[model samples]
Target: MAINPDAVGTTGTPVESSWTSKDSLLYAVGIGAGTTDLAFTTENSMNIAQRAYPTQAVVLGDASGAFANIGTFNPAMLVHGEQAITLHRELPVQGSVVTTGEVTAVWDKGKGAVVEVTSRSVAPDGEPMFDKVMSVFIRGEGGFGGERGPSGSRSMPHEGSTPDLEVTLTTREDQALTYRLSGDRNPLHSDPSFAALAGFDRPILHGLCTYGFTGRALLQGLCEGDPARFRSMEGRFSSPVFPGESLTVRMWRDGAGAARFSTHGGDGRVVLDAGRVTFDPA
Candidate 1:
Protein backbone atom coordinates (compact mmCIF):
# COMPACT_ATOMS: atom_id res chain seq x y z
CA MET A 1 0.00 0.00 0.00
CA ALA A 2 1.15 3.52 -0.76
CA ILE A 3 0.06 7.03 -0.09
CA ASN A 4 -2.67 8.38 -2.30
CA PRO A 5 -1.62 11.89 -3.26
CA ASP A 6 -5.19 12.73 -4.17
CA ALA A 7 -6.12 12.38 -0.50
CA VAL A 8 -4.01 15.32 0.51
CA GLY A 9 -6.92 17.55 1.35
CA THR A 10 -9.31 14.90 2.57
CA THR A 11 -11.13 15.76 5.79
CA GLY A 12 -12.27 13.34 8.42
CA THR A 13 -15.74 13.40 9.90
CA PRO A 14 -16.03 15.34 13.12
CA VAL A 15 -15.75 13.25 16.25
CA GLU A 16 -17.60 14.28 19.37
CA SER A 17 -16.64 12.80 22.70
CA SER A 18 -16.60 13.56 26.39
CA TRP A 19 -14.12 12.75 29.13
CA THR A 20 -14.42 12.63 32.89
CA SER A 21 -12.02 13.18 35.74
CA LYS A 22 -11.39 9.46 35.89
CA ASP A 23 -10.41 9.42 32.23
CA SER A 24 -8.07 12.34 32.80
CA LEU A 25 -6.54 10.66 35.82
CA LEU A 26 -6.07 7.42 33.90
CA TYR A 27 -4.33 9.26 31.12
CA ALA A 28 -1.98 10.80 33.64
CA VAL A 29 -1.17 7.41 35.09
CA GLY A 30 -0.68 5.99 31.60
CA ILE A 31 2.02 8.58 31.11
CA GLY A 32 3.75 7.46 34.32
CA ALA A 33 2.52 10.20 36.59
CA GLY A 34 3.20 9.28 40.17
CA THR A 35 1.73 10.08 43.56
CA THR A 36 3.41 13.45 43.57
CA ASP A 37 1.53 14.61 40.50
CA LEU A 38 -1.75 14.92 42.29
CA ALA A 39 -3.28 17.44 39.96
CA PHE A 40 -3.31 14.86 37.21
CA THR A 41 -3.50 11.57 39.06
CA THR A 42 -6.17 12.50 41.62
CA GLU A 43 -9.71 13.57 40.88
CA ASN A 44 -10.04 15.52 44.10
CA SER A 45 -7.03 17.63 43.26
CA MET A 46 -8.30 18.01 39.71
CA ASN A 47 -11.66 19.17 41.02
CA ILE A 48 -9.92 21.89 42.96
CA ALA A 49 -7.63 22.84 40.06
CA GLN A 50 -10.16 22.31 37.31
CA ARG A 51 -7.40 21.64 34.77
CA ALA A 52 -6.26 18.81 32.54
CA TYR A 53 -2.73 17.89 31.64
CA PRO A 54 -1.87 19.76 28.47
CA THR A 55 -0.64 16.58 26.84
CA GLN A 56 -4.02 15.00 27.56
CA ALA A 57 -5.27 16.91 24.56
CA VAL A 58 -3.38 14.47 22.36
CA VAL A 59 -5.76 11.76 23.45
CA LEU A 60 -8.77 13.96 22.77
CA GLY A 61 -7.33 15.12 19.45
CA ASP A 62 -6.47 11.65 18.24
CA ALA A 63 -7.52 10.99 14.64
CA SER A 64 -5.86 7.64 14.13
CA GLY A 65 -8.86 5.76 12.69
CA ALA A 66 -9.77 8.68 10.51
CA PHE A 67 -6.59 8.24 8.48
CA ALA A 68 -7.66 4.81 7.22
CA ASN A 69 -10.13 6.34 4.81
CA ILE A 70 -7.64 8.82 3.39
CA GLY A 71 -4.46 6.78 2.87
CA THR A 72 -3.35 3.47 1.42
CA PHE A 73 -0.04 3.24 3.32
CA ASN A 74 0.76 0.09 5.23
CA PRO A 75 0.40 0.56 8.97
CA ALA A 76 3.69 -1.23 9.53
CA MET A 77 5.58 1.38 7.55
CA LEU A 78 4.36 4.45 9.36
CA VAL A 79 6.38 6.36 11.98
CA HIS A 80 5.34 9.32 14.04
CA GLY A 81 7.99 11.93 13.22
CA GLU A 82 6.82 15.18 14.74
CA GLN A 83 4.01 16.64 16.79
CA ALA A 84 2.90 20.15 17.76
CA ILE A 85 0.02 21.53 19.80
CA THR A 86 -1.09 25.10 20.26
CA LEU A 87 -3.44 25.70 23.14
CA HIS A 88 -5.88 28.52 22.85
CA ARG A 89 -7.43 27.99 26.27
CA GLU A 90 -7.01 25.76 29.26
CA LEU A 91 -8.92 22.47 29.03
CA PRO A 92 -11.34 21.59 31.76
CA VAL A 93 -10.90 18.43 33.77
CA GLN A 94 -14.10 16.99 32.32
CA GLY A 95 -16.09 18.18 29.35
CA SER A 96 -17.53 17.41 25.96
CA VAL A 97 -15.38 18.32 23.00
CA VAL A 98 -15.42 17.91 19.21
CA THR A 99 -12.46 17.28 16.96
CA THR A 100 -12.15 17.52 13.18
CA GLY A 101 -9.07 16.84 11.14
CA GLU A 102 -7.75 17.26 7.59
CA VAL A 103 -4.75 16.06 5.68
CA THR A 104 -2.93 19.30 5.19
CA ALA A 105 0.16 18.17 3.28
CA VAL A 106 1.74 15.08 1.70
CA TRP A 107 5.33 16.05 1.06
CA ASP A 108 7.61 13.45 -0.48
CA LYS A 109 10.75 12.59 1.40
CA GLY A 110 13.27 10.40 -0.39
CA LYS A 111 12.52 7.26 1.60
CA GLY A 112 8.86 7.95 2.42
CA ALA A 113 5.95 10.30 2.31
CA VAL A 114 5.59 12.83 5.10
CA VAL A 115 1.92 13.31 5.80
CA GLU A 116 0.72 16.21 7.95
CA VAL A 117 -2.66 16.03 9.60
CA THR A 118 -4.02 19.09 11.38
CA SER A 119 -6.87 18.81 13.82
CA ARG A 120 -9.00 21.48 15.45
CA SER A 121 -10.62 20.71 18.79
CA VAL A 122 -13.45 22.67 20.35
CA ALA A 123 -15.56 22.58 23.47
CA PRO A 124 -19.28 21.75 23.22
CA ASP A 125 -20.06 25.42 23.56
CA GLY A 126 -18.00 25.96 20.38
CA GLU A 127 -15.02 27.40 22.20
CA PRO A 128 -11.82 26.65 20.27
CA MET A 129 -9.59 24.64 22.55
CA PHE A 130 -6.48 23.82 20.62
CA ASP A 131 -4.84 23.04 17.29
CA LYS A 132 -2.77 19.90 16.77
CA VAL A 133 -0.44 18.98 13.94
CA MET A 134 0.80 15.44 13.60
CA SER A 135 3.46 14.52 11.10
CA VAL A 136 3.85 10.90 10.05
CA PHE A 137 6.47 9.27 7.85
CA ILE A 138 5.14 6.48 5.67
CA ARG A 139 8.06 4.37 4.48
CA GLY A 140 8.14 2.92 0.94
CA GLU A 141 5.31 5.19 0.00
CA GLY A 142 7.10 8.22 -1.38
CA GLY A 143 8.12 9.44 -4.86
CA PHE A 144 4.47 10.06 -5.59
CA GLY A 145 5.23 13.25 -7.51
CA GLY A 146 4.46 15.44 -4.54
CA GLU A 147 6.53 18.25 -3.01
CA ARG A 148 10.07 17.15 -2.20
CA GLY A 149 10.25 17.92 1.51
CA PRO A 150 8.41 19.31 4.52
CA SER A 151 7.62 22.99 4.70
CA GLY A 152 7.30 25.17 7.80
CA SER A 153 8.58 22.32 9.94
CA ARG A 154 11.79 23.92 11.02
CA SER A 155 13.67 22.66 14.06
CA MET A 156 13.86 24.79 17.19
CA PRO A 157 17.10 26.63 17.87
CA HIS A 158 19.22 25.02 20.54
CA GLU A 159 19.12 26.39 24.08
CA GLY A 160 22.77 27.26 24.62
CA SER A 161 22.66 28.22 28.27
CA THR A 162 22.88 25.70 31.07
CA PRO A 163 19.55 24.04 31.78
CA ASP A 164 17.77 25.51 34.75
CA LEU A 165 15.61 22.45 35.23
CA GLU A 166 16.03 18.70 34.70
CA VAL A 167 13.96 15.61 35.48
CA THR A 168 14.57 11.96 34.67
CA LEU A 169 11.91 9.25 34.52
CA THR A 170 12.42 5.57 33.83
CA THR A 171 9.77 3.72 31.90
CA ARG A 172 8.53 0.33 33.09
CA GLU A 173 8.97 -2.74 30.91
CA ASP A 174 5.24 -2.96 30.23
CA GLN A 175 4.92 0.79 29.68
CA ALA A 176 3.44 0.48 26.20
CA LEU A 177 0.79 -1.94 27.37
CA THR A 178 -0.12 0.44 30.15
CA TYR A 179 -0.25 3.44 27.83
CA ARG A 180 -2.41 1.61 25.26
CA LEU A 181 -5.37 2.03 27.59
CA SER A 182 -5.19 5.75 26.97
CA GLY A 183 -6.66 5.03 23.50
CA ASP A 184 -3.70 4.58 21.14
CA ARG A 185 -3.58 0.84 20.69
CA ASN A 186 -1.16 0.83 17.76
CA PRO A 187 0.53 -2.54 17.31
CA LEU A 188 3.82 -0.82 16.60
CA HIS A 189 4.00 0.01 20.29
CA SER A 190 3.28 -3.60 21.21
CA ASP A 191 3.12 -6.98 19.44
CA PRO A 192 6.75 -8.07 19.15
CA SER A 193 6.44 -9.91 15.83
CA PHE A 194 4.70 -6.95 14.26
CA ALA A 195 7.48 -4.71 15.54
CA ALA A 196 10.07 -7.08 14.13
CA LEU A 197 8.32 -7.07 10.77
CA ALA A 198 8.45 -3.32 10.88
CA GLY A 199 12.28 -3.49 11.31
CA PHE A 200 12.37 -2.71 15.04
CA ASP A 201 14.07 -5.17 17.34
CA ARG A 202 11.30 -4.74 19.87
CA PRO A 203 8.20 -2.68 20.42
CA ILE A 204 9.03 0.98 20.89
CA LEU A 205 7.29 3.49 23.10
CA HIS A 206 4.58 5.57 21.47
CA GLY A 207 5.91 8.99 20.52
CA LEU A 208 3.01 10.52 22.43
CA CYS A 209 3.88 8.45 25.45
CA THR A 210 7.30 9.95 25.45
CA TYR A 211 5.66 13.32 24.93
CA GLY A 212 3.63 12.74 28.06
CA PHE A 213 6.73 12.08 30.14
CA THR A 214 8.30 15.22 28.77
CA GLY A 215 5.24 17.19 29.78
CA ARG A 216 5.45 15.68 33.23
CA ALA A 217 9.05 16.80 33.49
CA LEU A 218 8.04 20.34 32.62
CA LEU A 219 5.17 20.36 35.08
CA GLN A 220 7.25 18.99 37.90
CA GLY A 221 10.42 20.94 37.32
CA LEU A 222 8.85 24.29 36.46
CA CYS A 223 5.16 24.38 37.21
CA GLU A 224 5.44 23.14 40.81
CA GLY A 225 3.18 20.22 39.95
CA ASP A 226 0.47 22.50 38.73
CA PRO A 227 -1.37 21.29 35.63
CA ALA A 228 -2.98 24.69 35.25
CA ARG A 229 0.42 26.23 34.68
CA PHE A 230 1.07 24.18 31.57
CA ARG A 231 -0.30 25.78 28.43
CA SER A 232 1.44 24.19 25.45
CA MET A 233 4.19 21.81 24.37
CA GLU A 234 5.77 20.62 21.11
CA GLY A 235 8.63 18.36 20.15
CA ARG A 236 10.13 16.46 17.24
CA PHE A 237 10.70 12.73 17.56
CA SER A 238 14.41 12.11 17.11
CA SER A 239 14.84 8.44 18.03
CA PRO A 240 12.89 5.52 19.37
CA VAL A 241 12.88 5.00 23.12
CA PHE A 242 12.71 1.44 24.37
CA PRO A 243 10.68 0.66 27.44
CA GLY A 244 12.57 0.40 30.76
CA GLU A 245 15.05 3.04 29.64
CA SER A 246 15.45 6.33 31.50
CA LEU A 247 14.65 9.66 29.85
CA THR A 248 16.21 12.93 31.05
CA VAL A 249 14.51 16.14 30.08
CA ARG A 250 16.67 19.29 30.20
CA MET A 251 14.96 22.63 30.05
CA TRP A 252 16.22 26.20 29.84
CA ARG A 253 13.92 28.97 30.83
CA ASP A 254 13.46 31.45 28.02
CA GLY A 255 11.63 33.70 30.43
CA ALA A 256 9.28 33.38 33.40
CA GLY A 257 6.75 31.03 31.85
CA ALA A 258 8.34 29.77 28.62
CA ALA A 259 11.17 27.36 28.02
CA ARG A 260 13.12 25.49 25.36
CA PHE A 261 13.92 21.90 26.17
CA SER A 262 15.08 18.48 24.92
CA THR A 263 15.09 14.89 26.15
CA HIS A 264 17.80 12.28 25.93
CA GLY A 265 18.03 8.72 27.13
CA GLY A 266 20.53 7.43 29.66
CA ASP A 267 22.49 6.15 26.65
CA GLY A 268 22.98 9.81 25.65
CA ARG A 269 20.88 9.39 22.53
CA VAL A 270 18.43 12.16 21.84
CA VAL A 271 14.89 10.86 22.05
CA LEU A 272 12.94 14.08 21.70
CA ASP A 273 14.49 17.32 20.53
CA ALA A 274 13.75 20.91 19.64
CA GLY A 275 11.16 20.96 22.39
CA ARG A 276 9.27 23.98 23.64
CA VAL A 277 6.86 24.58 26.49
CA THR A 278 4.65 27.46 27.52
CA PHE A 279 2.91 28.22 30.80
CA ASP A 280 0.38 30.66 32.10
CA PRO A 281 2.22 33.87 32.90
CA ALA A 282 3.09 34.34 36.50
Candidate 2:
Protein backbone atom coordinates (compact mmCIF):
# COMPACT_ATOMS: atom_id res chain seq x y z
CA MET A 1 0.00 0.00 0.00
CA ALA A 2 1.06 3.60 -0.51
CA ILE A 3 1.75 6.10 2.24
CA ASN A 4 -1.27 7.57 4.01
CA PRO A 5 -1.08 11.33 4.00
CA ASP A 6 -4.18 11.30 6.13
CA ALA A 7 -2.18 9.54 8.85
CA VAL A 8 -0.96 12.88 10.05
CA GLY A 9 -1.78 13.35 13.74
CA THR A 10 -1.94 9.60 14.41
CA THR A 11 -0.30 8.98 17.79
CA GLY A 12 1.34 5.79 19.04
CA THR A 13 1.13 4.23 22.45
CA PRO A 14 3.55 5.52 25.06
CA VAL A 15 6.81 3.56 25.06
CA GLU A 16 8.92 3.13 28.17
CA SER A 17 12.64 3.28 27.54
CA SER A 18 15.46 3.09 30.05
CA TRP A 19 19.24 3.09 29.96
CA THR A 20 22.25 2.76 32.25
CA SER A 21 25.62 4.42 32.72
CA LYS A 22 27.20 1.65 30.65
CA ASP A 23 24.78 2.31 27.83
CA SER A 24 25.64 6.00 27.81
CA LEU A 25 29.36 5.26 27.85
CA LEU A 26 29.00 2.83 24.96
CA TYR A 27 27.11 5.47 23.01
CA ALA A 28 29.85 8.00 23.73
CA VAL A 29 32.49 5.66 22.35
CA GLY A 30 30.25 4.66 19.45
CA ILE A 31 30.17 8.29 18.32
CA GLY A 32 33.99 8.62 18.52
CA ALA A 33 34.48 9.85 22.09
CA GLY A 34 37.87 8.88 23.53
CA THR A 35 39.86 9.05 26.73
CA THR A 36 39.91 12.83 26.46
CA ASP A 37 36.12 12.77 26.80
CA LEU A 38 36.30 10.97 30.11
CA ALA A 39 33.17 12.55 31.46
CA PHE A 40 31.08 10.82 28.81
CA THR A 41 33.16 7.69 28.22
CA THR A 42 33.83 6.72 31.81
CA GLU A 43 31.58 6.25 34.78
CA ASN A 44 34.37 6.51 37.33
CA SER A 45 37.31 8.79 36.73
CA MET A 46 39.23 10.96 39.12
CA ASN A 47 36.88 13.84 40.02
CA ILE A 48 35.01 13.24 36.78
CA ALA A 49 31.31 12.47 36.67
CA GLN A 50 29.57 10.51 33.97
CA ARG A 51 27.52 12.56 31.52
CA ALA A 52 25.23 11.61 28.67
CA TYR A 53 25.70 13.09 25.23
CA PRO A 54 22.81 15.39 24.45
CA THR A 55 22.15 13.51 21.19
CA GLN A 56 21.79 10.29 23.12
CA ALA A 57 18.20 11.23 23.53
CA VAL A 58 17.61 10.10 19.96
CA VAL A 59 18.18 6.49 20.90
CA LEU A 60 16.74 6.57 24.40
CA GLY A 61 13.18 6.03 23.17
CA ASP A 62 11.28 4.13 20.48
CA ALA A 63 9.23 6.39 18.22
CA SER A 64 9.25 4.50 14.96
CA GLY A 65 6.11 2.68 16.03
CA ALA A 66 4.13 5.68 14.88
CA PHE A 67 5.18 4.96 11.33
CA ALA A 68 2.89 1.95 11.30
CA ASN A 69 -0.10 4.20 10.84
CA ILE A 70 1.62 6.02 8.00
CA GLY A 71 0.91 3.05 5.70
CA THR A 72 3.13 0.38 4.19
CA PHE A 73 6.23 0.98 2.10
CA ASN A 74 9.55 -0.67 1.35
CA PRO A 75 11.53 -0.38 4.57
CA ALA A 76 14.84 -0.74 2.76
CA MET A 77 14.01 2.19 0.51
CA LEU A 78 13.56 4.58 3.41
CA VAL A 79 16.50 6.86 4.17
CA HIS A 80 16.90 9.43 6.83
CA GLY A 81 16.24 12.80 5.24
CA GLU A 82 16.56 15.07 8.28
CA GLN A 83 16.68 15.07 12.05
CA ALA A 84 16.10 17.67 14.74
CA ILE A 85 16.07 17.51 18.51
CA THR A 86 15.26 19.87 21.35
CA LEU A 87 16.49 19.20 24.85
CA HIS A 88 14.48 20.79 27.63
CA ARG A 89 17.03 19.78 30.24
CA GLU A 90 20.35 17.99 30.62
CA LEU A 91 20.09 14.21 30.23
CA PRO A 92 21.15 12.12 33.17
CA VAL A 93 23.73 9.37 32.72
CA GLN A 94 21.12 6.73 33.46
CA GLY A 95 17.40 7.32 33.34
CA SER A 96 13.98 6.32 32.03
CA VAL A 97 11.39 8.14 29.99
CA VAL A 98 7.89 7.56 28.66
CA THR A 99 7.84 8.54 25.02
CA THR A 100 4.87 9.11 22.72
CA GLY A 101 5.23 9.32 18.95
CA GLU A 102 3.02 10.96 16.33
CA VAL A 103 2.93 11.27 12.58
CA THR A 104 3.29 14.97 11.80
CA ALA A 105 3.48 15.35 8.04
CA VAL A 106 3.88 13.52 4.75
CA TRP A 107 5.10 15.29 1.66
CA ASP A 108 5.00 13.93 -1.87
CA LYS A 109 8.09 14.56 -4.01
CA GLY A 110 7.01 13.01 -7.33
CA LYS A 111 9.35 10.02 -7.30
CA GLY A 112 9.35 9.69 -3.55
CA ALA A 113 7.64 10.68 -0.30
CA VAL A 114 8.94 12.32 2.83
CA VAL A 115 7.42 11.32 6.17
CA GLU A 116 7.96 13.46 9.24
CA VAL A 117 7.45 12.06 12.72
CA THR A 118 7.68 13.79 16.08
CA SER A 119 8.28 12.16 19.45
CA ARG A 120 8.10 13.55 22.96
CA SER A 121 9.70 12.07 26.05
CA VAL A 122 8.76 12.85 29.61
CA ALA A 123 10.56 11.89 32.76
CA PRO A 124 8.80 9.88 35.48
CA ASP A 125 8.05 13.09 37.36
CA GLY A 126 6.05 14.29 34.29
CA GLU A 127 8.63 16.85 33.21
CA PRO A 128 9.28 17.04 29.50
CA MET A 129 12.81 15.91 28.79
CA PHE A 130 13.29 16.05 25.06
CA ASP A 131 11.51 16.21 21.69
CA LYS A 132 12.70 14.76 18.40
CA VAL A 133 11.51 15.28 14.85
CA MET A 134 12.68 12.92 12.13
CA SER A 135 12.04 12.90 8.40
CA VAL A 136 12.52 9.87 6.20
CA PHE A 137 12.48 9.71 2.42
CA ILE A 138 10.89 6.61 0.93
CA ARG A 139 11.67 5.92 -2.69
CA GLY A 140 8.85 4.90 -5.12
CA GLU A 141 6.17 5.90 -2.66
CA GLY A 142 4.99 9.14 -4.18
CA GLY A 143 2.83 10.22 -7.15
CA PHE A 144 -0.29 10.25 -5.06
CA GLY A 145 -0.73 13.96 -5.86
CA GLY A 146 -0.34 15.21 -2.30
CA GLU A 147 1.04 18.58 -1.29
CA ARG A 148 4.75 19.11 -1.98
CA GLY A 149 5.26 20.72 1.41
CA PRO A 150 7.36 23.77 2.36
CA SER A 151 10.88 24.14 1.06
CA GLY A 152 12.97 25.33 3.99
CA SER A 153 15.53 28.11 3.63
CA ARG A 154 19.22 27.46 3.82
CA SER A 155 21.45 28.58 6.67
CA MET A 156 24.69 29.26 4.91
CA PRO A 157 27.92 30.89 6.02
CA HIS A 158 28.40 34.52 5.10
CA GLU A 159 30.31 35.31 1.92
CA GLY A 160 34.00 36.19 2.42
CA SER A 161 33.74 35.29 6.10
CA THR A 162 35.60 32.47 7.79
CA PRO A 163 33.75 30.06 10.03
CA ASP A 164 33.78 31.03 13.68
CA LEU A 165 34.58 27.50 14.82
CA GLU A 166 35.88 24.44 12.95
CA VAL A 167 36.55 20.97 14.27
CA THR A 168 37.63 17.78 12.54
CA LEU A 169 37.10 14.27 13.90
CA THR A 170 37.87 10.87 12.41
CA THR A 171 35.68 7.79 12.64
CA ARG A 172 37.09 4.32 13.20
CA GLU A 173 36.93 1.68 10.50
CA ASP A 174 34.65 -0.27 12.84
CA GLN A 175 32.67 2.76 13.88
CA ALA A 176 29.38 1.43 12.54
CA LEU A 177 29.89 -1.85 14.34
CA THR A 178 30.21 -0.16 17.69
CA TYR A 179 27.41 2.23 16.93
CA ARG A 180 25.06 -0.61 16.05
CA LEU A 181 25.23 -1.76 19.65
CA SER A 182 23.13 1.23 20.55
CA GLY A 183 19.87 -0.45 19.37
CA ASP A 184 20.26 0.20 15.62
CA ARG A 185 21.47 -3.10 14.23
CA ASN A 186 20.43 -2.62 10.63
CA PRO A 187 22.47 -4.99 8.46
CA LEU A 188 23.06 -2.18 5.99
CA HIS A 189 25.56 -0.86 8.52
CA SER A 190 27.22 -4.18 9.38
CA ASP A 191 26.56 -6.78 6.68
CA PRO A 192 28.61 -6.26 3.59
CA SER A 193 26.35 -8.45 1.48
CA PHE A 194 23.28 -6.56 2.59
CA ALA A 195 25.03 -3.28 1.95
CA ALA A 196 25.94 -4.46 -1.54
CA LEU A 197 22.31 -5.20 -2.24
CA ALA A 198 21.48 -1.74 -0.95
CA GLY A 199 23.75 -0.20 -3.67
CA PHE A 200 26.58 0.82 -1.33
CA ASP A 201 30.10 -0.44 -2.01
CA ARG A 202 30.12 -1.70 1.53
CA PRO A 203 28.43 -1.16 4.86
CA ILE A 204 27.95 2.56 5.31
CA LEU A 205 27.94 4.46 8.56
CA HIS A 206 24.53 5.28 9.98
CA GLY A 207 23.56 8.87 9.26
CA LEU A 208 22.60 9.22 12.89
CA CYS A 209 26.11 8.17 13.87
CA THR A 210 27.50 10.98 11.78
CA TYR A 211 24.92 13.25 13.36
CA GLY A 212 26.16 12.14 16.77
CA PHE A 213 29.70 13.10 15.84
CA THR A 214 28.53 16.51 14.68
CA GLY A 215 26.62 16.95 17.93
CA ARG A 216 29.80 16.24 19.87
CA ALA A 217 31.55 19.03 18.02
CA LEU A 218 28.71 21.43 18.80
CA LEU A 219 28.68 20.44 22.46
CA GLN A 220 32.38 21.11 22.79
CA GLY A 221 32.67 24.18 20.59
CA LEU A 222 29.46 26.08 21.40
CA CYS A 223 28.17 24.74 24.69
CA GLU A 224 31.52 24.66 26.54
CA GLY A 225 31.16 20.88 26.96
CA ASP A 226 28.04 21.39 29.02
CA PRO A 227 24.97 19.49 27.89
CA ALA A 228 22.68 21.87 29.75
CA ARG A 229 23.67 24.70 27.47
CA PHE A 230 22.65 22.89 24.30
CA ARG A 231 19.08 23.86 23.46
CA SER A 232 18.37 22.45 19.99
CA MET A 233 20.02 21.17 16.82
CA GLU A 234 18.76 20.33 13.32
CA GLY A 235 20.42 19.16 10.14
CA ARG A 236 19.78 17.43 6.82
CA PHE A 237 21.66 14.38 5.57
CA SER A 238 22.80 15.14 2.05
CA SER A 239 25.10 12.16 1.49
CA PRO A 240 26.27 8.91 2.99
CA VAL A 241 29.45 8.68 5.05
CA PHE A 242 31.61 5.56 5.19
CA PRO A 243 32.60 4.28 8.60
CA GLY A 244 36.21 5.48 8.55
CA GLU A 245 35.87 8.83 6.83
CA SER A 246 36.93 11.97 8.66
CA LEU A 247 34.28 14.66 9.20
CA THR A 248 35.03 18.37 9.44
CA VAL A 249 32.37 20.52 11.05
CA ARG A 250 32.37 24.22 10.21
CA MET A 251 30.26 26.61 12.26
CA TRP A 252 29.27 30.24 11.73
CA ARG A 253 28.04 32.08 14.76
CA ASP A 254 24.71 33.88 14.40
CA GLY A 255 24.91 36.28 17.27
CA ALA A 256 24.71 34.94 20.83
CA GLY A 257 23.12 31.53 21.39
CA ALA A 258 22.60 30.66 17.71
CA ALA A 259 24.78 29.20 14.97
CA ARG A 260 24.79 27.74 11.48
CA PHE A 261 26.97 24.81 10.51
CA SER A 262 27.69 22.00 8.05
CA THR A 263 29.62 18.74 8.18
CA HIS A 264 31.76 17.62 5.28
CA GLY A 265 33.29 14.25 4.59
CA GLY A 266 36.97 13.61 3.98
CA ASP A 267 36.47 14.14 0.24
CA GLY A 268 34.98 17.63 0.85
CA ARG A 269 31.43 16.50 0.01
CA VAL A 270 28.71 17.96 2.20
CA VAL A 271 27.46 14.97 4.18
CA LEU A 272 25.29 17.04 6.51
CA ASP A 273 23.92 20.45 5.56
CA ALA A 274 21.55 23.22 6.55
CA GLY A 275 22.66 22.79 10.12
CA ARG A 276 21.08 25.01 12.79
CA VAL A 277 21.87 25.09 16.48
CA THR A 278 20.56 27.12 19.41
CA PHE A 279 22.02 27.27 22.88
CA ASP A 280 21.34 28.87 26.25
CA PRO A 281 23.09 32.23 26.41
CA ALA A 282 26.03 32.22 28.73
TM-scores for every candidate against the unseen true structure: 0.89, 0.97
* Candidate 1 residue pairs in backbone clash: none
Q: Compared with the true structure, what per-residue lDDT tens digits does model 1 show for residues 203-281?
A: 9998899999898888888888776677788889998999888999999888778999999987988889988888876
Give the top-scoring candidate (TM-score).
2
Per-residue accuracy of model 2 over 1-282 as CA lDDT, tens digit each: 699999999999999989999999999999999989999999889899899999998888889789989999989889899999999999999999999999999999988999999999999898999999999999999999999997855657663478899999999999999999998999999999999998989999999999999999999899989998999999999999999899999999999999999999999999999999999877
For all candidates in order, the CA lDDT equals 0.82, 0.93
Off by over 4 Å in 2: 152-160
Question: Where is model 1 poorest over a 10-residue stretch in terms of lDDT?
Answer: 150-159
User: What is the alpha-carbon lDDT for the whole of candidate 2?
Assistant: 0.93
